[model samples]
Target: MSDELTAKLDRIPDPKTGKGLQAAGRLDGVAVRNGVATIVLKVEPDEAIDRLKADIESAAREVDEVDRVQIITTLQRPAGGGRDKAAPRQASAAAPRPARQIIAVAAGKGGVGKSTVAANLAAALAKAGQRVAVLDADIHGPSIPRLFGLRDIKGLRKTDTGIEPADAHGVRVVSMGFLTKPGQPVVWRGPMIQGAIQQFLNETYWGDPDVLIIDMPPGTGDAQLAIAQTVSIDGAVIACTPQDLALDDARKAIAMFEKTHTPILGLIENMSVFLCPHCGEPSEIFGHGGTRAEAEAIGVPFLGEIPLTIELRERSDTGRPVAFDDGPVADAFARAAMAMLDSAREARKPAPEIVFSS
Candidate 1:
């Protein structure tokens, strides 16, 4: 059966070298099983590598027994490549500092407390003595400035190297809200949005930090794809409420990540329950436990849950995330942040500097 799969691969030619992937020594290995195959391609990262991957997957699916295919891109270290002896990078005479792991806090829609989660997560990580930075990728509606209490401060400024992000509560932040007046909306096309996201990543003067959290825009849209293409994301945390609508959309979002081959760190159930102010009893205002069940169904970890309460809302509105105040909300965010750290660590891999975009 393995020989049959190899024969199928032999029929498909590599776009660059114009030889079979296996024969050309680019096919690292293949794992074929009951209707699922993971094709690992080992080659020098390049522009057309995405197309090559697609071609390889197409050939693998030709086997009548295979139903789904996954591809893991890996480093093809050149001859004599190692920490002690490596080739010079083309971008600079001196080697650039190694980048820290970047995690994107994403959601299926707006109003899911995504910004609040993102802001509090950054604060919690920072409080734990880790340097952190956040990029508000929600271009259409930037909320980091207000959440971090930097709305009054100047937005991004041009530095000699690139642009400078705002500082708040021990975390560096960059957002379109800082660029424009409060309540102003960003009206732009897809390409413009893509460019803005790229600039935030490649052009920001982000000194080496412990963790970089990107508050991805609501829903699976251009910003998500832009991030996937811009950098090698270490992991993504999908935020969702306990409502049925949110769970349905979250499933779709999970499918999107799966299709793109991005690792899902875990699922966070935000606003899991509403604490009654008077009776102090937990109420299922927006339903309850749906997100945890969804996470289990999808085979991802159920990171943690945050209850809906007035204190959490008030702190976020005042640009003082409960994470700084150290309350119930703070505890919730801290727990989720630590889980995210664990997930990122588990999913860590050696990625190349150049991304292969289609």
Candidate 2:
């Protein structure tokens, strides 16, 4: 039995480093008694706790002889000593959320490249060496799976902690597309939609990303309200074409976020202009700078603009986001993404400490 437990521990991999648990020295102490396995882990507070828990549970399941698994994690201070016993209780109560920041990319109406912007922004952030995740909360029109070429991916695996998210384009992705079949229309009512959004927040395994970009459904409806209540949204990025009609809806979107007390990070003026690929001439096909003017009028930062290029549409349709390839469109997305990050930084407050005691 002891040998079996050792074998199981040997097979367990460190979720952060992807090395075997024994190789990473994460499996410090192990004791098996009567088919129950007990393990002790010494980890840093910055380590991915959700991943660690999942790895241990997965290893335990692989060992048929093990009926149950117990894991205990202890945090060590930077001074090579354990945490002080007298640490303030308030410190624990003020624990920060998993991700340092969460930005929602939303639009007043569809066809404004909201999801495209969200996906590309997440990809560009990852390219800039920031850990990022994209949550496709557009239940009725989830395009994230297709954008990242994860349409055929399997459902997320459940561990002791929560459901694990899929990885693509160096960014973690969770989408309602993964939950329902292809081409199936989701006709869920308000309560059900709200419940699903809540599950995405509380149940999905997001690990410890630096930022999370939520692709909210287009509108200022019940879905938007549910997201506001479910997640601690650090800020919102409203996307709109430079058209009067779009700007009108965009203002409503911004107002909705403001009413919920979520900071408006900035506004993205998508489709601000269209450039002829061959002629190199720019044209305001939808009437330009309306979103920017609206942002300024409403007291929010104007992030940047993206042109309506043929390549942008083709790339999106092919499941190859423009951000993944180098070109004018890629550069545009990178700039827009950086601007959003800067706005988020300006809007953020210091994170509070979290304390966990056994």
Which 10-residue window of candidate 2 scores lowest in summed lDDT?
Answer: 84-93
lDDT of each: 0.78, 0.78
Give one digit per residue, the lDDT tens place, for model 1 in 207-313.
Answer: 88888999989887767776665676777899999999998888887877775667899999999998877787998889899999999998898889998998888
**Candidate 1 global TM-score:** 0.70
- Cα error, residue 319 of model 2, in Å, equals 1.5
TM-score of every candidate relative to the true structure: 0.70, 0.70
Residue pairs that clash (backbone atoms under 3 angstroms), model 2? none
Which residue pairs collide in model 1, if any? none
lDDT of 1 at 74: 43
Which regions in candidate 1 have their CA more than 4 angstroms from the true location?
Answer: 1-99, 349-358
Please give the RMSD to the true structure for each candidate, in Å. Answer: 16.1, 14.0
